[model samples]
Target: MTADRAAAPAVTAGRAPAGEDFGVYLVTDTELAERHGHGVLGVARAAVAAGVRIVQVRDKTASARDLLALTAAVAEAVGDRALVVVDDRLDVVLAARHAGHRVAGVHLGQSDVPAGVARAVLGPDAHVGLTANTTRHLVEVAAMPSGTVDLLGVGVVHPTSTKPDHPPALGVAGFARIAATTPVPCVGIGGVELADVGPLRDAGAAGIAVVSGICAAPDPGAAAAAFVAAWDGAGR
Candidate 1:
């Protein structure tokens, strides 16, 4: 039973769990800073202004202290309007919690903390999510311990410079196939642009996760709004 539970589905529904809708995933990088002249918090503020339902902060390079500070700033900016998610750092997640951020969740990649461990450490209320870019990983997500994660970042939907080593971009057909198999809210990440959000949503993405699409746009708020509009129109 223990072994079986360890592999139960993270999200049972094929789509986003209720109320989990279109979102903007933020990844902090030098390009984002250079282009926007602000860090993750600035992007989150813009996204929220543009009606983003959720925000995931993914900073692969920030130190734990830097991430914690950023997370606090992000939480303050988002306030009660948007769900704030920290990227692959459990310690940061804990720090956010300790700081009374009421943060919504944490998103982990394949090599980050184990989902079960994360669930246990994050407690039962905090939302947990994972990245899965392949059909095999989708199947694995479907079999993850139930309630271990609340959503999935499933992509590299198109070839991206962000994760250049990520397996081939899962084009429309591949997106559909993976979506069909994933029993979770699958958010399309990697190379998503405002123009692509609608189609990606149509391909069964619960939301679109972006880096450059929003952060690097001339006006991050407007770019995020466009994605929100596109997702709404896509009917996904």
Candidate 2:
């Protein structure tokens, strides 16, 4: 991580609903289990057991048909245990809704549909999040009058395999600068790990989005627990 990236307060790392201090950011990795050859449902179940409150299904490569099927299955696995979200593709979001899937919302990146468009399609109940890499971008999106979005993702705090083309890591300080300017809850993305939770929460992030940190672990449930513990300990 760059010097600026390291200087930001860890946002998602400190608090839990129970008022415990876990010192780790909330885990949000739905695609990581696929890397280890675990089925989507299995991975999601493991994540919920580990205290993950949210899951984002981000399979860009999956065909539309396959994506919907996978979404349905993962949604079933999460089943009230976690808030399941679909990444990008509003079509999948629609399909998930139609299938009686318990999807909580959609996460949109820069190239995906605009937040207003997504809100129109998903209706009033779904949660929407936007990705902002710079202060300008963050301000532009956060200041929009639409009021369609529920949250923002503010960084690749460090290099991440999940988004290879993402710009260089924003590190901690850059994240704090961007996050400090936004009123919406922010989640730090990219290269997040247990150790980074404390600083991330301090930076004002509502949570941390992770991929390999939990997915790549030998025991995903344990990994998930560790992440939650870290975030809770940080006083988020």
Candidate 3:
């Protein structure tokens, strides 16, 4: 292990997970950010300033080098304002950590690397997350050794062009059904908006993850603040 990984805390079962509040998770979409005249890093900085507690740098199309560069930039931009996670890129996470960036961890899709393996590679303290849209998925994650995973990015809560291939939109009701069954914290994603925050929270979601709601907003910071207000108002 590198010095940074060696120095990282060992997060075992029974310990407090890193992303407990999860309140206002922001998943970046470069296209959406660019549409609003902000690069991913710029938008992330703005959102973090407005209470976005978690920022996931997700660029499926970028080259590995570019993604690493982007992740490092985001790590710098958010600083300690938010936990910086790279979506579906374990190598990038390791590389970023090796380079001395404060990338907290990674968010993996169900099809990506297994959480157990990710935890092993990232060491115990890395805040690993996984996607779970079905009851079976939830059960599988629940069965994992504790501390192997930190959070669940549960959804396609609504239809979203950002992930056209995502399984059928879960909608609020479907989302609630899945969220209710999970032991780990769930952040409702995919087409989520400010109005859905209270309802999703009421439905047992620990947080709300958004792309366009903030990334494409005319004012990213204000949009993020709205999400924060809605989440807090729900008493989460």
Candidate 3 lDDT, 1-236, residue by residue in tens: 11122233432212223434667889999988987799897789889878777788999999999999999988877745567888999999899989988888888988888999999988876788899998789889988998788888888999999898989999999988987787788889999987798889888887889998899989998999898888878862
- Where is model 1 poorest over a 10-residue stretch in terms of lDDT? 1-10
lDDT of each structure?
0.71, 0.70, 0.82
Task: Report clash pairs, candidate 1.
Answer: 7-143, 8-143, 8-144
Candidate scoring better on lDDT of 1 and 3: 3
Tens digits of per-residue lDDT for model 2, 1-236: 11122233322211112221212223334466656776566667786777676677777788988878877777777746556777887888787788788876678988888888888777766767788887667767866775577678778999887778889898998888887887777788899877788898898877788778877777777887787777767762
What CA RMSD would you report for each candidate? 7.3, 7.2, 5.7
The TM-scores, one per candidate, come to 0.86, 0.85, 0.91
- Model 2, TM vs. native: 0.85
Q: Name the regions of candidate 2 deviating beyond 4 angstroms.
A: 1-32, 35-37
Residue 52 deviation, candidate 3, in Å? 0.4
Clash number for candidate 3: 0
Which is better, 2 or 3, measured by lDDT? 3
Local accuracy of candidate 1 as per-residue lDDT tens digits, 1-236? 01121232333112223554545555544457566676667777877777675677766777899888888887777746666778888888788878888577688989998887888877777778888876667767767777777878887888887676798888777777887776677788878776776677677776778778777878878887787677766763
